[model samples]
Target: MKTKYWTIVVLALLTAMMSVAPASAKPVTVKGKVTAKEDGSVIIGCSVLIKGTRNGTLTDTDGKYAISANTGDTLVFSYIGCITQEKTVKSAKLNVVLQESPEALKESMVTGYTVGESVEDVSSEEIRIMYVPVRQELPSEEYNEIVENGFMKVKDTPLSTFSIDVDAAAYGNMRRYLNKGQLPPADAVRTEELINYFSYDYAKPTGDAPVKITTEVGACPWNPVHRLVRIGLKAREIPTENLPVSNLVFLIDVSGSMYGAERLDLVKSSLKLLVNNLRDKDRVAIVVYSGAAGERLPSTSGSDKQKIKDAIDELEAGGSTAGGAGIELAYKIARKNFVPGGNNRIILCTDGDFNVGISSGKALEKLIEKERETGVFLTVLGYGMGNYKDGKMQVLAEKGNGNHAYIDNLQEANRVLVNEFGATMHTVAKDVKLQVEFNPAQVQAYRLIGYESRLLQDEDFNNDAKDAGEMGAGHTVTAFYEVIPAGVESDYAGKVDELKYQKPEKTVPVSLSKELLTVKLRYKQPDGDSSKRIEITLADDKANKVSVDFHFASAVAMFGQLLRDSDYKGTATYDKIISLAKTGLGKDAKGYKREFIRLVEIAKGLDKE
Candidate 1:
C-alpha cells in the first residue's frame, strides 16, 4: 500500500510538471522561394507571415525567404494581385506557388478595339458587329506644359545655372503610358529624369564633400556635329546601419478618387515595404485625409511594425480630399515629435487630386514652403492613372525641399523603398544647385538637355537664402549639354546682331584655356544654414571611348527628345535608340536597362499608330 501511494504521488507530480513546461515544438528556420502558379515566374517582395503571429518577412529579389516557425504552425504567403496561400509548416523548407486573383486578371485586361475601322467609320447599324471592349470614360489628367530649352550663345549667356533635380517621377510615369499601348503626352516626358532613373557607376565621394563630380564628353549620337557633355554627381552613400534615426509621417490621401486597386491599394503596399525596413530607433505616424484630415496612428516606435502596418491596412478610400488640412496636421505631428539632429520627413502618397480647400498648386507650394522651415523635409509619391495631378505634386516637392517619385507597381515600390532605402529617405545635402560656365574657345553655342522648370538665376547660385533641391544619400544626378562646336554653321546657333549700345567685351585670359566648361556646385549640409561650394573644370578633349553609363544616358536623352518631338532631335530613330541601349547594357543586375530597351520597342510600335 505504501509503494502504490508513492507511485501515484510521483505520477501526479510528473503530470503537474509537464503541464507547466514550455512547448516542445521549437521554432525552426524555414526557407523557401515564392513563385507564380501560372507562369512559374519568381515573385519579389512577397510577404511571408507565421499564422496567428506578428512575425513576418519579405522575399528578396530572388523570391527567396527565411522565417522561423514551429512544426505545426501555419505559414501564409501573400503578394499584391496574387491570391493568398496558407500551408502547414511540416518541414523546414516549404515553397509556395500563388495564383493570380480573378480581380487582378480582370484589371489586367487591355481594352481591345477592332483593327482597320475607326469609331466614326462604323455605322450605327454595323456597330454591333465591331468588337470593342467596355471601358470607363477617360478621366482628365493634368500635366504642366514643358517648353524645351533652346541654344544660347556662349558669348551672351556665359553661365547656365539651375537647381539639381533627383526626382524620377517622369520615367515611371512614361513607362506606364507605353505599357498601355499608348504614347505619353509631349509635356509628360522629362529628359533629365529619364536619364537619372538608372544607376551609374560614378566615383564615390572620398573627402568631406558629400558629393563628387565626374565629367565626360563624347560625340552626340543623334547629331554627330554637336558634342555631348555629361556631368555626373554621386552623393556619399551611408550604410543602412549607420543611418540617422528617423521621425516619419505618412501623409496619405484617401479621397473618393483614390478608390481603386492601383491608387490607395498600391499606396498601402508601398508604405508597408517601407515600414518593414524601419529600425527600432525610428518612429512613424500616419495622417490620412478624406472629407477631413485626421491622425490614424500617433507617433509609434518602429519596433511596433505590426501596429503601423495594421493602420495602413485599415485605410479605405472615400469622400473628398482635404489635402491642405492633412499636410498641416502632418507637419504639426512631425514638429511635435521632432528628433533633434535626426531625419524628420513627411512622405505624402496620393493621386494629387485635391477638391477641398487649398487645392491650387501655388497654395500648396506656399504651405509646404512654410512647413519646410521646421527642419522637416517632404517626399511626394504620386500614384494612380487617370486624374493624376502631376503639376501640384511637383510644386509641393520642389518647394518643400524634398524629392518626388511615382509608384506605378509593386516592383517600383521595392526599388524605391527597399533597394534604394538610404537614397530615398536620408538627405545628406540640401539646397544643391549647379552652374556651368561655357568657354567660348571650346564651344560656340550650347543647350541644357532638360531642366526647364529648374532654371535658376545666375545670382541664385551664390545666394544662400534661395531654396534649391535636396540630395539624398547614395543619390546620383546627371545632366547633359549638347554643344555646337565653334565654327559649326548651324541654324541653332543663329547670328545675333551686335549689341547696339556696347562694344564687344574683351575675351578673358581663361578663354584661352583648353577647358570646355567649368562646373560649379553649391550645397548645404542637411542641418546647416550656410552653403559650401565646389568647382571642377572639364577639358576640351573628347572621350575616345565613353563609359557604358554615358552611352546609356545618351540613348535615354535621345528617346525623350523623340517622344517630346523636340526641334533638336536630329536623325534620332527608335532603331538607333534601341541599338545604343543594347551596347550600353552593362551587367544590368536589376534589369532596368533591358527594360528600357523593351520600352523603346513598345514606343516604336505605338509611334507608328
Candidate 2:
C-alpha cells in the first residue's frame, strides 16, 4: 500500500511539472536600421543573416530591414567596405552601425596594367606586402569622342531618328571619377545616360505591347527660352515567380588587369548575389579568360547555388586578356544550353582590357555581331577603373544587341544583380528605334540632347534588318530634346546659307495641326524577327503640369553638360542643379536621388579645386 501511494504521488508530480514547462520560444519580428559609423549615413544593400541558417535579407534603400528571429538567436550584419557585426536577439529591435574596415579599404588599391609583368623574382608573400594603394590617373584608360549635336531647322530636318539606348555605364563611370575628387573626361559624360540612370514614375504597358510611352514638355531649367521634351518608355514588369527560365553564361575576365578588389573580387560577390536569386528552372555556366578561354563551371542547376558560388570564389586573375575568346566560349555554352522562348543571355563581366587576338573594337564588334545572331543576347558589365576600355565595351554592347553597366561597388552590384534582376537579365523588346517628327509650326529648331553614337538614318527606323537597342523587363528609357519654339531667335539656331540651285519644297498641310510632335517606335518581340510599330501624337497641351521626373532628369542633364563644359549649358550652375534636384526629390524610397544630390555636391567641390 505504501509503494502504490508513492507511485501515484510521483505520477502526479511529473504531470504537474510537464504542465508547468514553457513552450518553445516563439519567433518575434526583429527590425532595425543599419548605418555607417564614420558618417552615420544609412548603408544601402547591407546583408542581414540569421546565424547557422540560410535565411537572409538585404536592407532596403532606407537601410531598414526586418526578419524573424527567436530569443537568444544570433544575427549577423555584413556589407562591403564595412566591418561585420553580430548581435544576440534579446529584443524585438536591434540597430547596427558598421565601421569602415581598414583591410577592405586597402584592397581597393589601383594597380595599373599588371598584364605580362615579370614577377618571377619576387615571392608571392613579398608581392602581397608591396601591393599598396596608388592614387594616380592611369593614362591607358580610353574613351570615344562625343561631338555635341547642333540644332537643326524643323523645315529641313523634321524627323529626329535614333536607336534607343538603355546603357547607364557612362553615368556610373562618371560617378567613379567624381568620387575620386576629379571631373570625368568630357567624352565620359553622356547626357542621355546620366538622365536615364534614375528611375521615373512612368506607366507600364496594359495591353499585349511590351512597352509604354510617356511624353512631357516643360520649360528648360538651363535655358528658359527653350522647351525640353521628355520621352519615356517603360517596359512591362513581370513578377519574380512568373519570370521565364533563364540560361545564363557568366563570361568573366580573369586577366591580370582585373586583379584588384574592385575588379575580380567584386565580380565574384556580385555573381554570388545573383546565384542566391536563381530559381530551380534556371541554369548557369561560367566561362573565364586570361591569355586563353576556358569553362570554369558547366551548366549547373540553380538549385546548386553553393556549387556555383564555389566556382566563382575560386577564380584568380592573371595573364593577358583574351576577351574575344571568352566571348566565343560563352556564346557556345549559352547556345548549348539555350532555353527556347526563355531568357538566354551571356553576361560579360570585364574591365574591357583585351590585348590578345581579335581585340580591336571593330574586330570585336564583328565577332559579337555574328554571334549575337544566334539568338543569344549579351550584357556587358564593366569593372575596375585604370586601363578600362569603355570604347571597346560600348562597341561590343551596342553591336551585340546588349546593354552596358559599370559596377563600381558592391552596392551597385546589388542594384544591378539583385534589385533589378529581371530588367538586367531578361529582354522584352529588341531593335527598339524611335523617330520624332516635329511640327514646323510649333517648333522652329530642335536638337537631341545626347545619343551622339546612337543616331540612326531616318530609314533605319522602319528597317527590321537594322539592329538597335534592346529593352529588358521593367526597363525604362528616357530621351530629352531641346526645342526652340517658333519665332524664338537663339544662337543655337544658326543662320544657314541658302542653296541657289535648290528650290524650296511646299509645306504639308498637316504642319498646321496643333500637335507639337509625333513619336513613332519600332521594336521586335524577344524571339521574333519581324518588327511592330507604335505611334503617338502629342498635342500642345499647355494645361499639363510638369512632373517631378522632368525636373530631376533635367537636373541630371544639366549636370552632365556642366561636366562636359558644353557650349549649350546656358545658365546651368551646380547651385541651380541642386535646387532643381531638391524640387524634384519626390518619394525617393531607394535614396538614389538623394545620393545623386550628394554626388552633385561632390562634383561642385571638385570643380572648385
Candidate 3:
C-alpha cells in the first residue's frame, strides 16, 4: 500500500510537470550547488559525466559543476579520491555534493613506494621497474546532450550513488586494510611491528629446478569469508647458481607496543624458523626499530647458523617505535654492505604499528623513497592481529619493491614455507595486473567489490615502473567479480525511471557478446633482470553450470557478500555456498573438499550468535 502511494505521488508530480510542458518532451530544470570539502570551504574543480558516455562538465570557481543529464542517464561525478558519484538526474537541478577524498588526507604511499621516494623503489635491480596499472571511470557524452538539449527527460525519481573505490596501491601500496569492526587508538599501537606481519614463505636454496609453489587466495570453499592464502617455499628456490651475492638485512621492530606474546614471541619464533631454513649460500643481517632504532646483527653468512640463531635468541621487545629511524637504519645497513647483484634484500618484521616518529605520509615517503636506489629489495612480514596496521605494511612492501602478507600462526608458517616456495623466494612475474572491460550489451552498471583500495587510474597502465601486485613462480591468485545482467530490474538501487535508457538501447535481447573480459599479465624471470609478458582472455559462456570458473568465482563472491553483508546478495547464503562447492568439488586432489564441508559446519555454528 505504501509503495503504491509513493508511486502515485511520483506520477502526480510528473503529471504537474507535464502540464507545464509536453508528454514526450524535454528535461525540467533542476538546480543545485556543489560544495568541496567540509562546509564547502574550498571550491572543487571536477568533471560531471554520464556513466558510459564521455560528455561532462568541469567544476567552476566555487567547485560547482553542472551537467545536463536525463531521467535514465547515470551521472558520474569524479575528482581524485573523493567518491565518484553516479546518479540519474530526474528533475535536473542537482545540487551535487562532492565530499573530500579520504585518500587526500594521507595518501602518499603508492604500493610500498612512498612519496619523496625514488621511482626505482617501485622496482628493483632484478625487477628493473614497477607500476600500479589502473583504470578510472570515463565521463558520459551523448546522454548529457539529450538532457541539455531537452530530448529525453523522465518525470519519475531515480537512483544515484557517491561511491568510488580508493586506489590502495596509489596512496600506500595497500590492497587490504586491517578489517577493524571498530577503529583503534594510536598510542596503543606499534607501527613498525604492524608493518611487518605477513609470513612470506621463504624457500631453501636448491640446485635450481625452478621450484613451483601454490597458495589459496581465500578460505576453503566451505567458509568463504575466511579466505586462506597459502605460501609455498622450497629448496634451490630463486637459485643463486648464476645470481650475484646478496647483501641481506633484517629489520625488526621492538616497540613498547610489541610487548605481547603474539607480537614479540611471534616475531622471534618466525625469525627462528626462517633462520633454521636458510642455506649456507646466503648472507644475513638484522636491525631493530623502537622509539629509536639499532642494528642487532651485521652481514653474516648462512654457514654461521650459530651466529644468526644466537642473535635471534638474544632479541627483546620494548620502547615506542620510531618507523623512520628503523627504515633509515635498515637502509644504511644495506648500503654499507651493498652487494652489486647477488640478491640485496631487507626483511622487515613488525606489526605495522607506527605512532611515534616519522609516521606521517610526506615524512615516511621522503624517507623510503630515497632508500630504494641502493638496490635493496624489501620483504614485509606482519605479526599480531588486533590493531594491526595492514595498510602501513603494504606500503613498505610496495615501496620497498616487495610483497605483504599477515601471519597468524604456525600452520600459516608452514603454508608460506613448504607450500609456496617459488612465489615466496623466486620472482616469476613482477607488476602483474588485471583489467576487465565489461560489454555493456551483455551487462549493465558493473560494480567491482572489495579491492576498494586497489582501483588504479587509466594512465598508470603502460608505465613499466608502476608498482602492482607480485606473482611468484607457479603461484595462482583468484579474484571474483559479480555483474548484473542488462535489463534486470530491482526496486532497490535502480539507476533510472521507466525503461528510458533500455528503450532504443535494446528491448529485444542482444546476442550477448561472448568475450566478457580480458586478462593481461606481464612478468620477469626471477634470475633475469628484464621483464616479459603474457595474456589470457575470459569469455562469459553462461553455459556448463556443472563446474566452471563462473561457478567458482560466483561462490567466492557470494562468500564475500555474506561476510561484508552487501545489498546485492539475494537468496545466496552460507548453506547455499556449501551446496554449490560440494556439487563442483572437482578433483578434490588435496582432500580440501572434506575440509571445506567441515568449515561450512563451523561457519553455521558461528552465525548462531
Off by over 4 Å in 3: 1-247, 339-341, 490-493, 497-513, 522-533, 545-556, 581-603
Alpha-carbon TM-score of each model against the true structure: 0.81, 0.81, 0.56
Clashing pairs in 2: none
The local distance difference test score of model 2 is: 0.83
What TM-score does model 2 achieve against the real structure?
Answer: 0.81
Q: Can you write out model 1's per-residue Cα lDDT over 536-595, one digit (the tens) per residue?
A: 998866654789988899999999999999999999999999999988998877667876
- The collision pairs in model 1 are none
Q: Per-residue lDDT for 382-459 in model 2, tens only?
A: 998789999889889899888899987665676778778888888899999999999988999998999999999999
Which one wins by lDDT: 2 or 3?
Answer: 2
lDDT of 3 by residue, 417-472 (tens): 33443445445444554444445455444444444334455444445555555554
Best by lDDT: 1
- What count of clashes does model 2 give? 0
